[model samples]
Target: QEGVKRWLNGRDDAAFSRWQLSRQREGQFIDLLLAVRDELDRLYRQPLDEPSMGQRKARLFEQLRERYQQLKQQWGGYAGFDGWFSHDLNNAYLASIATYEAWVPAFQQLLKQAGGDLAGFYAASRALGELPSPQREQRLQALLQAADP
Candidate 1:
């Protein structure tokens, strides 16, 4: 019985660690997404009728492409960005901005609930994820409600 308890505890610990790592990766993704969004916004905000608009857009795209190539090198040849910039830039910017706007407040609330304990936040997130779909949605809604100032 003691051995079984130990094994279960070990499993739970591993799962918690995975969740923590997942959250870290998610934060990285959000950071990259925001950077891309900002670059696209800078291009979009320029007047279409500006004399050098095409040139400016081309310069911005080249800059963004260089950044993406650097990121790929940093990430050990990760191809995640291969088609990221090929899509409609405005749609991509809107989606990224929407994700950031929606994610930050909920993450803050989770941190608050955990009293700033990252491990505790991961455990809570794992628990919520383990619930049935309906229950998970309900719990998420409650958390969002509590998050409201």
Candidate 2:
């Protein structure tokens, strides 16, 4: 095993190898997270009438939450200086996710108010969708006005 090899190779050697492995895992995680987020973004725009849209949304949510929780668990604890730095950035990202999750009900309500048709008001709002949530909300509100009249 890599760990066994590292152990036999000595402490300094182990440290570098350990860091290398961690960096590799981090890269893999980032690629996976980006891909899944893309999936979520693409699938989320579907109108409710599509037969499999609900299933797709559910799958995306499950994937998102699983990765979110995995990262939280993976990075949650103290790991001296290196971890303290990553921890700050990780916590900031998780905080944003928390804020976004809190908005889910409101987003769903907006869909309801639109009578569940996301394409009309929503399709015209992709530029806003690319913004951060607060800015996106403002842009979406402006788009809604345009879409309506």
Candidate 3:
């Protein structure tokens, strides 16, 4: 718990810095996926409404392919992200984005509730973790709601 508190508070640790860098890279990847999804939506919105679901899906895929190629070229032909262009991967990426968007603010609120005290924050976090699954989720939801402006 102490180690986690240190890491969470951004203490001077090489591994923590590396973890932060990896998170930043993940954020960049999420941004790229979002851009691709947005462009595809803008380009293929009309086609997506076609009566034939199969045709609409085909059109969507076609646009995705075009946009992906453009993205690759924009990134100076970096193919390391080729695996992220799939339908399943895109869904997973979106889910991850949603989770991050929801949880970060809630955690921030929890920290604020602790008055920036790391020990208090850890104790509060442990209390939350010890709750039953449903209760834990309810508490998390409450935190999220409280964090909302």
Candidate 4:
């Protein structure tokens, strides 16, 4: 919707300009979040048994830290911008959190049904569970560390 040149092409309409900016920020946030999540999935798929867990978890946190910074820094990208900027951010955050909560439990149950692959599933879930808040950094690291054999 944002690429519709007729609507968002010119800076003439302040509302349209704001809408474009908000869309850009939203895209950036989603990109970063997805990238971090993809890395988590990669970690889970790796065949390493024990020693690599700490290293992998550390890398995951580093990627997440970058994503968090990206979100926080670009947060001001919508400042004074209009067209549901705050609403978009809030909704995105809420949706991300809610989706994770829904996904993790359902995923755990699915893993159990498929047999015991808790380690692989939890590896991703553990990282995602830490993402909603900064305070979980330490605990998440510890959990990931302990997840190692």
Instruction: Choose the strongest candidate by TM-score.
Output: 3
For the record, the alpha-carbon RMSD of candidate 3 to the native fold, in angstroms, is 5.7
| Model 3 misplacement above 4 A | 1-88
Give TM-scores for every candidate, taking all chains together and pairing residue i with residue i: 0.45, 0.33, 0.50, 0.38
Whose lDDT is higher: candidate 1's or candidate 4's? 1
Q: How close is candidate 4 to the true structure, as a TM-score?
A: 0.38
Q: Where does model 4 exceed 4 Å of error?
A: 1-12, 50-55, 70-149
Which 10-residue window of candidate 1 scores lowest in summed lDDT?
Answer: 1-10
lDDT per residue as tens, model 1, 49-110: 76587667667656667776776777677665577667645535656566656655666687
TM-score ranking, high to low: 3, 1, 4, 2
Runs off by more than 4 Å, candidate 2: 1-11, 49-53, 61-149
Clashing residue pairs in candidate 3 (N, C-alpha, C atoms within 3 angstroms): none
lDDT for each residue of candidate 2 in 12-109, tens digit (9 for 90 to 100): 77677777766656655555455665666666576666668767766765665566556656666423223423432332353455555445445545
lDDT of 4 by residue, 72-98 (tens): 666853333233233423224534754
Q: lDDT scores for all predictions?
A: 0.66, 0.55, 0.66, 0.55
* Segments in model 1 whose C-alpha atoms lie over 4 Å from true places: 1-26, 39-48, 91-95, 98-102, 107-149
Worst 10 residues of 3 by lDDT: 86-95
